[model samples]
Target: MGSRRHTWVRRLGAAWLAAAAVVGTAASSAAASAPTPTKSTAGPTPAELKRVDAHAEKQRERLRLPGMALAVVKDDEVVHRRTWGKDGDGKPITRQTPFLVGSLSKPITSTAVMRLAEAGSLRLDAPVRRYLPWFRPSGPSADRITLRNLLNQTSGLSERDGIAHADRFDNAPGGVERTARGLAGARTGAPPGERHEYSNANYMLLGAVVEKVTGQPFGDYLRKSVLRPFGMDGTLVDERDAERRELAPGHRYFFGHPKRFDPPYDASGVPYGYVGADIDDLSRFAVAHLGHGDAAARAVVSPAGLRELHKGTVPAGTSHRYGLGWRDDSFEGERVVWHGGATPGYHGTVVLAPERGLAVVVQDNAYSPQRDELLNATALGAMRILLGGRPAAASTDPMLDAMLTTVTVTAAVLALALLWSLFRIFRPSRGRPRGRRRIVVGAAVSVTGLLVLAVTAVYVLPRQVTVDLSEILLFVPDTGWLLVAIGVLATALAVTRGGLAVRACLAAPPLARTDPDAVRDRRQEARAGV
Candidate 1:
């Protein structure tokens, strides 16, 4: 009986082991057949790119931008080129239309400098004074500044000294010297090489140095050395050349509508902010950034030099580093080097992700207070398209729409109040005839309003940008003119109200001034029918 039980146990054990083995095999096969996740390293799909178009269109509408042009380069080749607005004359903008690229000129200027260095004519670490003997930094202990300092914005120079933000040097050639001398008076903005304070004056000196050393007009040097070599024929370094090239007009907002301006005349800040190029020429510019230049591109600057141009030299912000002229950053785990530009009537941005083999350039023919973020918004959207991500949101605009709305509403209210003051001046008041106290209050308010506008225009704005009444009138017509008009109207109101208050005080009722007893006798006499 015991032997029979043992045999049964052995048979049961064998069955269980066979069943377990079968189940394990089935599980392994199921796992092998299940889907496995793989990382995506592909360019945008056709549908995805089409979606980017709609996305860009939406932004243009939401921002009320007049027009825009964009180009995308992938794998060192132009993959997409598009335009989405009309020129100031209502002509349709094409990829060939030129727009002023403001400070986007910096990187191109830096590229030229890098090439000069490779040619052994310039040194990145040399003192700026080594090239231009007239450049004298005021601080005795802070006399040291290099070409790298200027490119990285660590030159300890301020945008002030009445040069960078001022109207473009209306004069040329000869004027470049006079304007550069003015920079000699510039105070140190920071300890040299300590921190970054973006100053167009830094690049101004760079351009001057380039011209001095090259013995050529800075514009001519750029045209021959960089633009010509890269086959960017349509690009113009001089504003005087803009009209001959058939460039697009810059538009600024007036009463929330686009207003075109005549071309600007200044050239003092050209190296820092002004270069006119169409999307096609700009692509050639972008191609050079990828370090895959053809023989022609390589001839302008060696690939090694190009890489050096992008190598980070200092921290720009938390995640960004300022290279020679390019700004380095990591976006979504990928390296990106980019730059942005703003001018009176135009705004633009150019971005490059060398590791991903992509570049994007965007230009807009519109300017508004909110445009600083708007141009950035448009550029990042294009980057999203190239990187297989959806362009969903915009950059954080601190005060464009909000400040505009507030200013508009305040202007409307003030205008209406001024009209009411006019009515008060002519029409008599009821009851107590509004005491002198009311006029005093009105005058106080008018004076305060005028003072605020004046302080902001003269003291605050010039600190941020070199601006005068005339330029403000053209660039920010709606906001700037409203402040002026309101101030003038308020001044008039104050004078009128103050004069009325004094007259009212002098003309107080004579009867009320009489003695109380005399007033009682006159009332009694009237009741007696005298």
Candidate 2:
């Protein structure tokens, strides 16, 4: 009997193993037979591309963005380029539309500096005092400050003096001089070239240095040497006096209103030279940089100079670094040189992966309010396409990821608890009597609370701000306080509503009764219901 049992057990084990192997083979076969998604040559697949398009549209809608244009370049060719959103009059934005590239102006400035350097008209190591004898930073350090130092943003100067947020451009007499002198007189935050500090003042001073060296305004010098040479005829230098008929007005989000800024002059009397022109010209500029200084019938800088611009100068924290006006980030073992542009109302990003020969340009009218995760992902996605690799779904958004995880966990817990509460509340009872009055009161209270929160948030709070799109763009400063006050009101509404629901439940009939006779009635109803 023992021998027979052992033989039977062996046979059963063999049969189980054979069955498991067969199941495994079948599963593997099914997986292999499953249709794998093919990468689209035109762009991302319909669903993926739709998500990106929809996301851009939503941002435009929420931020009241007037227009947005994007161009993706692969292997030095513009593979896919599209424009979405609208102009001031609701006209569709096109490839030729010009949006202020904002701080993107720095790289262009840097290019001009390179040309000057190559011509021996300026030296990177030479101090600014060589040209602008009147230009001075604090004392000894000012004399030591070099063109390279300014480009690298290690000039030991705050980018700007304490300019009030409401006061955008300096309106004082000789505002540019006063602003420059104020920055020059400001105390140093670190020893010269000790560490990297992004100072707009550095670039501003560099602009002045260009003017001083070239015997013309910075704008004229940039036009003659950079823009004119490259045939980037659409690029504008003096945006202060831009033709209103041809210009795309910049817009900002105020409460719920999308407010545009009036033209004819920027806050600085210097013609908004620090940030100018739109996306297409910017990409042309990037193409020149990524293509080693020659692209689109323009040779803005020499190949060697372009290399210098991309050469890492100092460690940008731990993972990346800065080079001239460019940034160096390691993406999937490939070196990516990129830059971002931002002003009060608009945000722009230019990403280039030279090794992979990919470039992406993004310009958004809305300030992300968080570190720009979407912009980074877009760039990374473009880079992955250049590498012929699929972009993994892992999120690089720090704040968004945290918020999403918190929301998901909170939602799960709430859902489980809600289901549990409903299950218990609706459970069949043996003989308890129904309480229609309690249910009616609960429903009415809940409805009333929701209506009140909605009314306060949508109608009352927004009314306080007076979201007039027309007047604010005329450079009116009073709108700032209105927006702030309204945001506070909105926050108050959210907090009040969140707490009101729980508070309303406090008036709900008690599950336990104080009177002993009530318990008997409850028991009778429970029995009957059961």
Candidate 3:
């Protein structure tokens, strides 16, 4: 009886083992057929996205921005997006509204160059002349400038020189080539790779090089290789593209208020600062950079190549390093990769926290030199909010307010002074001195001083500010026109004062002939009488 029980137990055990194997096989097959989950699938919760939206809105209101668009991405998914106010066209800003992204185009251009490099079509360390033989900037070391130098902005191009050539508003074809050729006369301030200096000219030349190598228009190449592949269909590469899409206008700060500014399209600037795109387009770009298994990004650039683009190659500042086109810096002790862009009427910022898998893009319709820091901070604040930190309260820029106030007060004073001078010129005062020699000397001195002041205002001041007069007018019409008004008023005042002096001298009665003989006779007659 015991032997029989043992046999039965063995048979049941074998059957049980077989059944277990069959069930495991079925389970494995089901698991293999199920869809794979992605990190983006578990992105930031809705509540978190709502917080980011609220913070962004608050910042827009606090900054008094006329229009703004913001997007937040977690991993490869856009978790939140919002738009406020109106665009340059007075239409409510939407996901499709395009803003001139300014220097943000640098990164996009850099990616294109990198793509070519990866394909072995170009070498980063090769001199620019290898592609464009006519390329020669005015510097002894110009021959040493390599494609990498331009990519990292260490080609020794000066910001002042860049400003000199920027914002030409040239809408004609071949504008990029013309501008690049124009750089032959430009002098570099330092040796190639010696230091990093941000210059739009660097990218403009790169655009030219791309055209030469690819035998295609820069815009066409960019569209085929970068924009289209990345699904940025709304991005406008040049003036024609912008017009075709009816690109919205941007705003500039005038007396601390945002005003619509319909800037002329600059086709030459497309490679560096003129590329336009809406928020949705930029969100895709941000996702690609995050590298969270984005198929489109992978197809455009290899993972290693993307990493190289973000690597800090040179020191940009004490706290910042510049990669190919991105700035690597720390924000509140966290690694942040970012770039800030500003044209005349728009300001935008893209901030990425790679370690945290977070990206934020903030764009404001209005831009001002004084408000640049504040505008950029909005993106940083959004990042902080996403990281579970309360955003810092928006702070008013007292300095900007003071500057606008000073500009207004100075303008009024200049007008008053000019009117008073004109009044004095037309209606001479009885108490005015009647000495012709003194009047002539004073007028000559006053005219010379006024001429010097006018020249300095027109020339020296723009250099000191590191922008041309036209840029000042484009970005800050009030200040730009004020500079012009100052020159005009100073000259007018000088001319009127000099004219008054000349007229006074000519109108003065000929000095009474103090005849020495007459004086002597009078003295002799007095002596005789005595």
Candidate 4:
């Protein structure tokens, strides 16, 4: 059983690695072949809008999405706005239906921080401790972290640390402050400002900083300073407000099927990932960011401040850069400022091409870790259509359905094998092992291999995916529990085999063990059995 489970796990790993390689190659080739962004003064034509709508509907049906909302804005006007499918309540989704816009909240929070800076309330380059004297993490370098470092995600906090504190579902008072203070126990992978490591902890501390400086809750200040000015009237900064607006319950994929998941409000995560908005609300925010004669956009932040917010100050990857809250990158060689966000059950993306005076906002009620890239493609594909280019070929959904199916079948086989092993260990033996020494050695090797497999599955695999086991369990319960089952069954099998080997050694005949001919005969018998 241990050997069989090990083989299954190895096969799963190999499949994942191969899939990743294929995706990487496809992405690189797409980028290389993408045409340069063309500056167009005209908006998307009616036929173009039709194509966009058709594409959205195709994707929704193909992915079996529960609900979705999309809006395309040109200059200061929304040229196209549409919705398809139903919400958790079975009502049709609308422009005003609130959906949790995960890390898209970062831009709004960053906007609030910039407003404070514009009024001389705080300095971007100043150490965080300058404002919040209690601000201190474990490392000495923590003291040198500036507001800018957090904004650009160069505060030295790793993704692992962020996942550790994320999705806390803590609705209690002072959760944000508590999360910030709790970082005193968190370890940093690098010194502040030395590397760009995205972490929700950075924005959590920023939320605390906002609270300390403004003497108001992070939500309150963000609404007054950012949302209101941008005409995002349908937006809500916290769970209570979202509930009042009847925020649509989001969905999580279970074996390729969408299941409703009404996750608890994470108050501590609002600044980084939990803000809620509808398509209309996001469209207005996009228009504001575009800043092409939109008075609301001009009034909220100065040209200099807006530029700073979209500037790529730190490198994130080969072609991507992290700005204050936005990601500066290219879509088809066209410069685009964008950000995509996800929680347990929702996915959303906002893309802005200021040069072309175009912006796109796409939001869906369903989300899954495996479908993250595919969901993001919805927004990118829309942008491509608007840019008068054919959208890139759609990639596969990362084979999540296949992976989960394999896990299920493998678990069943392992369970049966474990049961058979247990029965063999307890049932009356047909005969004692003639090669007791060989049996013991083989069992020892099996136990050692099983233990190594268990450790790798429970620990190393999660790190390779840049998350912890807890996160996997929280987001992908089926996969997580199946992994636990495999490890447990392997251990059980190891114990049973070891016990049988020990019993054989104890029952062996001493004369047979001392005789070379008998030993050879026993070895032949054991080989035949094997």
Best candidate, TM-score-wise? 3
What's every prediction's RMSD, in angstroms? 20.2, 18.8, 21.0, 7.7
> Looking at model 2, which ten-residue stretch has the lowest summed lDDT?
28-37
lDDT of 2 by residue, 299-381 (tens): 55766787788766786545667778877776665677777765444557787766445677877554322224443444455
- The candidate scoring highest on lDDT is 4
Instruction: Output the better candidate (2/3) by TM-score.
Output: 3
Candidate 1 per-residue lDDT over residues 1-530, each given as its tens digit: 00001111222224323432442243100111111112125555677667667777877887677788877777557777789879877788887788888778888889889888888999988998898887777864356888888888888875444233444544466444556666875678677898876667777788888888899877888998988878788987666677677766778777666678666645556677777888888888887777654667757777667666776667766667777777777665567778887667777888887767678888888765444555576777778766766564655233444444555554565577667867866874554544445545665665555555444433344333444455545555775665566556546655665665666655545435355888898899999999
lDDT by residue (25-69, candidate 4, tens digit) is: 432111212111233568889999999998888888877899999
Ranked by TM-score from best down, the candidates are 3, 4, 1, 2
All candidates in order of lDDT, best leading: 4, 3, 1, 2
Candidate 3 local lDDT, 1-530, one digit each (tens): 00001121222224323432442243100111111113433456688778788877777876788899999888777778889999888899889888878888888899899999999999999999898888777786988899999989899987666666778888777888887887776788899999988788788889999998898888889989988777788898878788887877777777678888886888888788888889988887887777653466567877677777777778876677888888877655567778888788887888887766779988788877656667777888877767667665555455444544544554566578778878987787777446666677788877876666566556655655565567667765776676677678778877887788887887764444234676688789899995
Better of 2 and 4 by TM-score: 4
Candidate 3 vs candidate 4: the TM-score winner is 3
List TM-scores for all candidates, in order.
0.81, 0.61, 0.85, 0.84
lDDT of each: 0.67, 0.53, 0.74, 0.76
Q: What value of lDDT does candidate 4 attain over all alpha carbons?
A: 0.76
Query: What TM-score should be assigned to candidate 3?
Result: 0.85
Which ranges of candidate 2 are over 4 A from the true structure? 1-66, 139-142, 159-179, 255-258, 267-274, 292-298, 368-377, 388-530
Q: Write out the backbone clash pairs for model 3.
A: none
